[model samples]
Target: MNRISATRSELLARRAGIRLAIQGRDLLKEKRTALMREFDRLSADAVAAMQDLEEKARRARASLSEAVALEGPEAVGSAALAARNEIGVRLTAKSVAGVKIVDLEHDPVGRARTDRGYSLAATSPRIDTAAEGFETVVEVLLDFVAVELSLRRLAEEITRTTRRVNALEHVVVPRLEKERDFILNVLNERELENRVRLMRARSRTDERARQTGGLAERSPA
Candidate 1:
């Protein structure tokens, strides 16, 4: 610890620092509270999205199984090969509580039977059912991932803010208070010492005056 001067100036400066530290702690506390609220709200949505994603995946798998049974593995494989298309994903960004949130934007996944790239007459309708179910699953999966990412960012921000608040409250403000108290005590002691010295000096001066008066009184005439 750097020892501060035993003066009023250092005491005032320490007091100012203490006030700023307290204000900073309060602001960070507010930020933490806001982050928690947002996280709670999005966490609920994330749970529902996860459940929906699981259900969609299960249904998609069942439909694929039926398609394979009804239309032979070779035929289904041929259709899958023809219908395989690269999915385009468009991503955008937004901010919430000083955190970056990623948004998933894309075209609708469902398509008409004619649009599936396979000859409608050759492919069983079961293939289309399976394809549609899986596409829906993909869409929901995207939504679920987006929510999970947001929650993660919020959690991180909350942690950082909490740390900052703790540092100010536990470390910074207390240190300043200690320094201020030290300065105050030193100044008080110095003032007391000066007063004692002044009293001794006055006493000596009064004694010299009394001695001179006694000599004058004892002198002849």
Candidate 2:
């Protein structure tokens, strides 16, 4: 803290500072509340997404193993290679409480049998089933990733909002109030001292007049 003057200007400035800080704190509180709500909603979504991803992955793994055992590893590998396509992901930015989060979108993962370069006629049905199972897993994984990423960003924003609220409530506002109190006390004391000095001056003037009047009466006029 720096040395402060006991002037009306300083007092007014401190009062304004306190007012603005309180408003800011209130706004931050609102933001934190909103952010928490969003986090909670997304948290539930993330949990369900994770569960779905796990289940899909488990089924995909089993399917792949069965395919390899029945149709041979070479056939499964060739099918995977033929089905390969570039996944174009589109990311858009969205804001929550001044924090930026991304919205992820992508083209569909699973292709029709005719769309893929592979032919169902050439491959065993087991191989096709295995490929479709893995494709389904990929779809679930993308959803899980999106939810998790948003959750992470929201968590960070919540932390920052909490810190700001604490600083205002605990530190900045208190300091300003203390300074305002100091200034108010000093002004009151100065006012009291001026009043006492004025009263003393009036008493001395009254005593001098009385002495003058008594001397005139003694002088015989």
Candidate 3:
């Protein structure tokens, strides 16, 4: 490491820098803690959402199999082609502990037979059951994605904050403190040297004066 200048002003500046670094480190530590908390919460949410999605998916698969068995694959394909793509997804942003995350909004899925945009007379009950089950799966999957995304962002922020805190605490702050100590020692040494020089000069002046007085007192006139 390069040596710091041993000046009083330099020492003061180093001390101030260390103080600011310490304050910044503390704030980062707090931020890391908060992000970790949010991450944990989101993680739990994601897990629950995943479990729900899995169950919904299983049910949807079973219902689809039943529909295929009852109405035959050809009828189910015809029904799927007739169905309208009416699902609307709207996303909004939210902040969690300074991290931004996404929220979702959409039209309600799995409506009544009249609202399903398909003719009830044409579609069998098994087909309707399969449609509703699949829609539930999609909804739950969307929720799961949102939760997982938020968790990922929070985890990244927490890692970044932790790195910053460690750098300040272990590297920058310690270097500044060492520089401050070095400058102080230098200043003290200079002060002691100056004091010693001044004392020696004063002693020489007193000796000269005393010798001149003795000569004057010894003279006859």
Candidate 4:
């Protein structure tokens, strides 16, 4: 009887364990889904930002080349200085879906044209044009770097979360469930055997009592 009771208690405990494991599996799955969605959105945004930076860089280079050819290197330098003064670079930090991105600044300045319509100090038109063109290129590169880094970091985090979810769903949770089931089955079988044994014992006891009563009556005392 004691063994049977112990088995019954074990079965109850196993059932509880199964319930907890199942709940954990469900929660982890939800978290994985959310992380995947975030990863997708972030990846898309990073691609778009890279394309925009590239396009802008190309246009800036073209403009610088035209200005240098018309006015000379001196004019290009003046324009660059002016652009820098007019529009200074400003940085601001931003967070997207728990990922942090440093803010970027884009400031382009054009130099004033000389009386002769040439650059003030530099005479090489090609040199001036190249310098102007590179300013835009530099900005584009910076933007690309920021986006790429953020994307890489976000991807890493996503991968980590996914692994954890898979582990819980495929390995940890299943093992727990199997063990719980085994315990319950063992408990049930033990209890059933105990019930059968008790019935047999009770039957024997009743038969013995009846035989004793008959003997006592027949013996007349």
Residue runs of model 4 more than 4 Å from their true location after superposition: 1-20, 56-119, 123-129
Segments of candidate 3 deviating more than 4 angstroms: 1-3, 209-221
* Candidate 2 residue-wise lDDT, 1-221, digit = tens: 25789999999999999999999999999999989998999899888888888898898999999999988888888888998888888888788888676678988999877777786787887877788898898888877777788889899989999999999999999999999999999989999999999999999999999999899989964
lDDT of 3 at 96: 66
lDDT score for candidate 3 against the true structure: 0.85
Q: Indicate the TM-score of model 3.
A: 0.88
Off by over 4 Å in 1: 212-221
Best by TM-score: 2
Measured by TM-score, how close is model 1 to the native structure?
0.89
* lDDT digits (tens) for residues 1-221 of candidate 4: 22333455666675676677668767766665765676677678778877877787777677666776786767667655643433466666666445555556655444333422444465555544555566556656766665576667667766776677677678876765666667667767888999999999999999999999889989954
RMSD of model 2 against the true structure? 1.8
Error of 4 at 5 (Å): 14
Clashes of each: 0, 0, 0, 5
lDDT of each: 0.89, 0.88, 0.85, 0.64
Q: Model 1: per-residue lDDT, tens digit, 120-146?
A: 999878999998998899889877877
Single out the weakest 10-residue window by summed lDDT for candidate 1: 1-10
Q: Give TM-scores for every candidate, taking all chains together and pairing residue i with residue i.
A: 0.89, 0.92, 0.88, 0.66
